[model samples]
Target chain A: MTDTSDLRSPTPDPYLSMDLLRFTTAGSVDDGKSTLIGRLLYDSKSIFEDQLEAMETSSKARGDENVNLALLTDGLKAEREQGITIDVAYRYFATPRRKFIIADTPGHIQYTRNMVTGASTANLAILLIDARKGVIEQTCRHAFIADLLRIQHIVVCVNKMDLVDWSEEVYQNIVKSFREFSSRLQNIVEVTFIPASALIGDNIVDKSTNMPWYQGPTLLYHLESVYVGADENHVEARFPVQWVIRPHSDEWHDFRGFAGRVAGGVFKPGDEVQVMPSGFTSKIKAIYSMDEKLEEAFAPMSCTMTLEDEIDISRGDMIVKPNSPPEPSQDIEAMICWFSSGKTLSGRGKFLLRHTSKEVKAMVREVKYKVNINTLHKIEDDLEFKLNDIGRITLRTSAPINADAYKKNRITGSFILIDEHTNETVAAGMIL
Target chain B: MNYTITHLKQLESEAIYILRETAAQFEKPVMLFSGGKDSIVMAHLAKKAFWPAKVPFPLMHVDTGHNFPETMEYRDAFIKEMGAKLVIGSVQDAIDAGKIKEESGARASRNGLQTYVLLETLEEGGYDAAMGGGRRDEEKARAKERFFSHRNEFGEWDPKNQRPELWNVFNGRKHFGEHFRVFPLSNWTEMDVWQYIMAEEIPLPSLYFSHERDCIIRDGVIMAVTDCLELLPEDVPEKMTVRFRTIGDATCTGANLSTAATLEDIIAEVAAARQTERGTRADDKRSETAMEDRKKAGYF
Candidate 1:
């Protein structure tokens, strides 16, 4: 065996720790969404004895027959008492193959904000479809939201299959109809259809022998094996300097490096990079992962880089490839999901626009149109954007933010609008 | 970015990003080090975040006064080695100043008292951001926490109206006098932490390893017979091989009967262990909403 050693080597138990999948579950409350997640956690051996005991105790106290698995996710006291999920509750489960973080969200029109919040960080979204209800409005709404967030993998769990006798005809009909509707959604790379009964263990962890005609993998199997390596933007190079590291000590008097997680593309020691807002070009001298120097560094890695030239660079300044630089502009158009309770966008109204590492003053120049998520219809002339509203709007920023189209580079293209007075995050915007 | 990293490295990057966000977004920030494994790991990440520069923030410890001497020693050594400033908000001082009252009897502990001291310190220091080692996997209430948890002027958490965090961009903007409790270890599980510690070769207090300690079995949990503890008439100490899964207040933290002395042994035990690290503590057993209420009132 070739001996390879580095400052940061893989842990001894890499099998249990390497792969991680973050997914969100979405649907109407009665679609067995909670039960599906509960089954996954229960079967994956993620549930501890004390937690199960507490759930059983609560099940008894509530007179819930046969131990309601759905009760496992109701973490807050109000949620447990009111039987309504208020926000997204994250649950962790791991198998021998991979680890998973489940962002379980509430399903209600009023809780659309909650669903969007959960779906933002998910690589895959499990859209639970009630076998009886078929393709409902909530199903369409959830898929549209997931697609808007650019979640690549979509696992459509046609739950409550037992209610439909696990019939292949029903499963096929639902799958065919869903595919027809999902074709309209953009940026969803993969969609999986599985007939499962979350109430009883079926096609979740164990293959359901009842569905003899279904040859696809189980829900848990797909989650463990789904490919997520190419999810990040690898073409455009974007590195926003988060902090400048200058030791002000005698140990390394001239040591100066830019500390940041790579936003897009790959970077090497001799790569030519152009600093944003200042137009200073320099070659990267070295990359360091702590005390160890590396030949190359890439996206999402937390290594610091030093440049050949002593150019002035600070937080909010992006270092991009000189070959193709990010567009620096003061005016932009975007699709935003309004997260504020109050109607806060207007031509003259100002908000803090946080894009990449820079925060600038921005105002909505115009609200062009609002897309009705359920029907996927655009409603024009709706100039006012309210809470949980997804609409296309034009904005003017006080200063130029180096950015790209959201579809091209998510890290640089996406931003959030923060309120100036209350300091609450009011909206999530994607540059169009 | 065009890079693919291991899960441990991804976690480290995410944590370091959060620390940098806290430093860049806030006026004044402090990392809350409890002398626990999570805090130790967090401190280590902070060191790596801005390598060439001194850590942009100081560390604050809400000392309960009922801490194991080993933890105190470890905290001091860690501060010295890392060259991080330490701010100790003492619970004893809070009680002595008549700002809070002390509890008595078998259930007496400074675990809850640390909350008052912590809030007082945050207010006194005008700390705009307080980085904590609280992990979501530790408790039910904490599971819903954001990487940047915002608190009102009173430093209270509104579980109902938490800001939605998306991508790597965290919204840390807050009103004057309000601060955020940033949990860099929000996504980390206990197993992940132990695995990272072993991979990083981070040092921990001796209390984490199994050793001959005087302990007593109370309410089905092993309570270490430390000098900070107040024993009852029915409670008696016996020599037993024990190790603490977690370290907090001496009275509330429980030790497990084991001989898993090394880091690998602890990792295996944590993997096979049936209960959560917090499951053994008596503090969360107070009520169904014990942790929830404490969190709402700004408890770390």
Candidate 2:
């Protein structure tokens, strides 16, 4: 292909700055998830001396002959004793070509909400499959959730090749089965397969000597070279106001800038914009980034915008292009990932809805359907959604919310439901 | 003007956004300022979050009373410069009041006792949110924490029941008597903090840089010869060129032999170092699950 070796070289170039990638790992409890992460971190030299020492000592105390690299991520006492991840732990490391953020999520059925959390912002999802247990129920559940979350890229890491004796036939069989199943997904953009042994560090960060029949790039190579430039929302302009900056100083007494992060698309200084809720229209006069001003700002950059006209803008209000403004709706239909143990979400349940910078009271109007993750079937009769349950629900808000479909703009389309009495987050919802 | 955002700038924006959200969502939010590089950078970000508004909250320091004199001085000056209110919850006070008994022996430190004082202060202040400079890359236990970590009425964090933080949406909802610990720099690493401080020209305590200090060599670590550390017949004090990788109670925080004098020097040193910064914290070296144990007991 495209000289994968050259891409993995540690050459500092400015153009390679756009290659930043965020991915998540999901699999069953025994699918070698932690081993895969440990292999990636260790082979990439991301593990520190202290961390290695700690891992060695812990391994010795646990009566293991070799260093248990999985202990690297099993931080909690309960997690170590039970050998399961109870929460989503985020890890950060960088190769010369790109920076990476890995959301190590739990794979148990009870912790499915954590997976939803991890997959929400990820550009790619790496679903691990044990070679011995190819395409099990948990695999289907993880794949379906990946599809539901609209993850653009998926790298199926068939781990434990050592157990399968590095058989090419077994690898091809698993790949074929996964492909046939994934084809039924609604919007699966891409799915690539790689046979690896995470415990022995094969095909994770370097070329595997065992898998001679396979010719695909290593996991780290794929991560560094994957084209993620298109992951950002470049089609719609959305700016959710966080705070109003009024320097109120003698030098700039009249300077009023609306401070917020650019959530989607690009905004130039001369672009005509509309302020939500107030329905005020104006042109962007300036885009301030700490010390300097810019002509344009894009997704994920936090900056202050000074409009040509002084609009009644405040925190929780959204700024958008005048001609292509998102519709404000009080009634929203979304897929909800329940996260609270105190209450099961049902019809006419009052709670708080927190969208980007905005919190408004909302009520669940209807529970349309719940997906049985194992069977990949919709259970329309089941209306009650407890903790870690995912279902389609309609909600009515106290005030009209400016929004977009989650598939279109991840930054604007996501929301969390908060319990009124306990003030705990009860659910996570993604707009359809 | 042309405003180009480097990766560090993007991270700063994300941190500032989270800080603002905490301030807006919680009734009384306080920033935990430890006068270290991370907390100092966090204080600066807080200032930027509410320009001309005086940070919109007070800064609380759970003082172990065994802090470096330079760090205390730096904390006062920085707080004064920002025109923000400062509140100190002393572990010494807690010990004197018999609220928390000090640990005895060679490993005795006020590090664990600070948790009790911190929780008491949160209860007394009725603070619904407390912002910390904790970064996920610092330790494995920290890696599992949410940006908005919820604590019970007793200030206990149930790591198993954390809210799902998706996208940039942080859930800061908490009940009465309950508080949220907000970590704005969860994604930042030690190297990133140094680089940001260097680029932003953020001032730090002089203890972070190399200087000649009287220290005792114990278990291959330079222990600062402070009043809290009682010299043993076998332990001899020696003057050495040292700098702190992390700032904590003087009794437990160890110093490393280094000649990194400036921010740039520190950046270079960190880039070349193979050991993690927490390796220097004697508190974390107690056990494999030291951090997790402390976190479960409400140690921030």
Candidate 3:
């Protein structure tokens, strides 16, 4: 058994025993995004001295009045030199309550694929809108992508309030426009608007003295306190076995366990379950998280489960409850965000599809329609999905894959398309 | 009791997920162990990942031939403890075989030379995936590195043309000669690693804890006095209570004077410390794009 005796202290340290919150940042290219992220990190006291010193030097070299907070997040050489956010740069910070992983995604129209990739795993998203510009096309597009990705929380930070003299009229105007457009967005459960200045550091980490009009939680406070525990699908049980652990040792000779992360729902020690493909009926014998026997294992918990029956199972096999099992089918209808650069996804293209822990040969069966991201209108007759294009498509797999609708359970329903030729992740698909 | 996992437990689960993925996806995989805390944590996770079953993949140490004696001792004990097979890719062997030239004088280091040997080892071992204990929080350039970093046949990393790794799914597709340098610890920060070590009671080398050791100051950084580094006339060796933040080639690895004797002490030290963990490393201070330049040329 793996030793975990030292982990149990006399008293639980809240700071060390806290959870994590992963959030994504989306905004217009020049919406002071880097500055806002920089502000959050700096005010949160996560920025190290060396990084801050480097940012200061870069800001001096760039001849900016204030240290360019954006410089901290713009890690790549090309991105720094070009003064643009190209790729998604992940930033880390922690408070007494929670640890945050900020996915600083690019906001350009061409980088919609990057935005989608960032939001794919995020629980929350921060949509930055320039106070002067109000709710523009970029704001709507970010909100649409956030909604499409089913991000639970959206924080609308109406930034650059310093330029507008912290006027409530401009802030309310932007908030009103955002709410008007955002009301149409689906799946975004909570929407929050805060007026702040990224440059002068208002309403980010500390309470803003400038904004007596704003009375909501600070961006950092909300991030730490946001309820993400209920974001997963707790109704249907799903566990895709990623590995099988068999000791083959004398001490524990007959230890055959199916190891995987719980994709959805709760699994206890005596739950009646059925293995996919084989349809072998079994009852859960024991659930273990590295020697610690658990009463139950829920979504996202990596655990090993031993069954009452010795059924043959592999990496791609899934273990689900007898009730409301995910539909198994060879044909899959999905919305794919094409990511292949310089390579257009044509109809009838063959690719390797990976779902949960399943990987099978799949071919693009049909290209149904392309939806214009800017207008959110479905375009028919246009079947081609080029680089950074999101379109509806149908696929046929070589073998049957068990999966749920992407909206119902993001873990089991979502998959990535791999180009066997180039071996690159060509697209991210969400089962419809 | 809260069944929900904490950040440290969550990180452990995520690391295990990546390890299992590497084991399942690749034909031949190896864990890059260096006797460092990060690699030690990686090895421990590998144990939990395939509990009851011995670690499926072997451990490969890209020996710089400039290691602290304690590192080798810890490595041998760990290998024995885990019953893991050890494959050493020696820089000294390459130097002796004339496969690569050795650097001389103050700037000479086997630290950069390990890259070539690492690539050679991968090709020779027929390894399609080499798991490293690298974390993105260590360096700026590493922040953009994907969990499954693809390298061409020539062992080159194309930063601009990297794949987008989404969700828990990792695409480990490769050609005949190409392989992947997967990082199971990509998202973990320094505090998280120490916190995890404290939580799991993972054993590390004594060198990590503060001890009285002979050291010499170079570039305002205290480096342990070892055979790997030839001291200059002005360099004076001093006995001080120093511990290493990162374990690598002793020649370039700087030591910080501290009394962090226990895991709890280390965690407190890490939390209160202002500079980045890599701030003590002299190898990365070579240039602004030192890590980037080396990464492009296939450095883990």
* Ten contiguous residues minimizing lDDT sum, candidate 2 chain B: B1-10
Worst 10 residues of 1 chain A by lDDT: A1-10
Q: What lDDT does the true structure give each of the candidates?
A: 0.87, 0.84, 0.88
User: Each predicted complex: what DockQ?
Assistant: 0.61, 0.42, 0.63
Better of 1 and 3 by DockQ: 3
Question: Candidate 1, clashing residue pairs?
Answer: A264-B1
Instruction: Give the alpha carbon lDDT tens digit for every residue of A69-159 in model 2.
Output: 7777777788888767777888888766666889988888888988998998888999999999898888888889888888989999999
Q: Which lDDT tens digits does candidate 1 get at residues B150-217?
A: 99999899998899888889998888888899999988899889978987789999999999989998
Roughly what TM-score does model 2 have, to 2 decimal places?
Answer: 0.93
Q: What is the DockQ ranking, best to worst?
A: 3, 1, 2
How high is the DockQ of candidate 1?
0.61
lDDT of 1: 0.87
What is candidate 3's lDDT per residue for B1-300, written digit by digit as tens?
Answer: 233567777788899999999999899999999999999999999999888789999999999999999999999999999999999999999999999999899758888899999999988999999999999888888989899999999999988888998888898889999999999998999989987887777788999998998998889789899887899999889899988899899898999999999877787788888888888788888877789899999999
What's the CA error at residue B150 for candidate 2, in Å?
A: 1.4
Tens digit per residue, CA lDDT, model 3, A1-432? 233533565556666658889999986557888778877777777888977887788889889898777777777889889888788888899987898888888888899988998999899999998888888888888888898888989999888888999999899888888888877877999998888888777888778898898889887888989888888888899999999898889987999999999988889999999999788889999998877798888877889999999899988999999887889999999998999886888789999999988899999988999888888889887778888888899999999999789899998889999888788899999999
For model 3 chain A, where is the 10-residue window of minimal lDDT?
Answer: A1-10
